[model samples]
Target: LPFWNKGSHSPSNHVIVAFEAYRQLSQVSIRPMTAISSMANIHEDICATAKRKEAAVIILPFHKHQSLDGSLNNTRNDFRWVNKRVLMLSWNFC
Candidate 1:
């Protein structure tokens, strides 16, 4: 297991960006929890950030069963077998 670095700014930055992007969901009249695309982008950003820092990042891909299992299976598969420091928050949906 890789150590968690509290000093990392990437994760926190990703969180803030995610909040801002998702917050627009309400404004667009989109269904709650239906913004899987946005969430996926956020996950990718988080993963990329973690990869750049060589740190472990936990990712719970949104809509695990509906979106993740189908659309994100490839990315998840790649992450699973890769040697990078990362962790899948859940498999086959949360």
Candidate 2:
């Protein structure tokens, strides 16, 4: 396994960490759970799935890279736009 540097601002590494954490948590939690495996067109897919299943809450993870100085370095513009749109559309249900 590749090790990430402490306070690394790598988006891919962050995603890997997030998924692993979620996996571990799911194993110990007794509540029912579902994992969406696809990443293609994620924004659209998540919205469609939520609407179809009438999901109570949709958790969207935003990607951000922080520098050693504790300032945000690179932020994902695509995710930012998608999150905004999804929040707007889901307002009625939320």
Best by TM-score: 2
Which ten-residue region of model 2 has the weakest summed lDDT?
28-37
Model 1 misplacement above 4 A? 1-37, 57-94
Q: Clashes in model 2: which pairs?
A: none
* Superposition error at 37 for model 2 (Å): 13
lDDT of 1: 0.41
RMSD, model 1, all Cα superposed?
15.9
Query: Mind giving the per-residue lDDT tens digits that candidate 1 earns over 34-92?
Result: 12234335555555654555543344433222364456334455334432322342221
Tally clashing residue pairs in candidate 1.
0
The lDDT leader among the candidates is 2
Model 1 TM-score, 2 decimals:
0.22
Root-mean-square deviation of every model: 15.9, 7.1
In terms of lDDT, the poorest run of 10 residues in model 1 is 28-37
Number of clashes in every candidate structure?
0, 0
Q: State in Å the error of residue 55, model 1.
A: 0.6
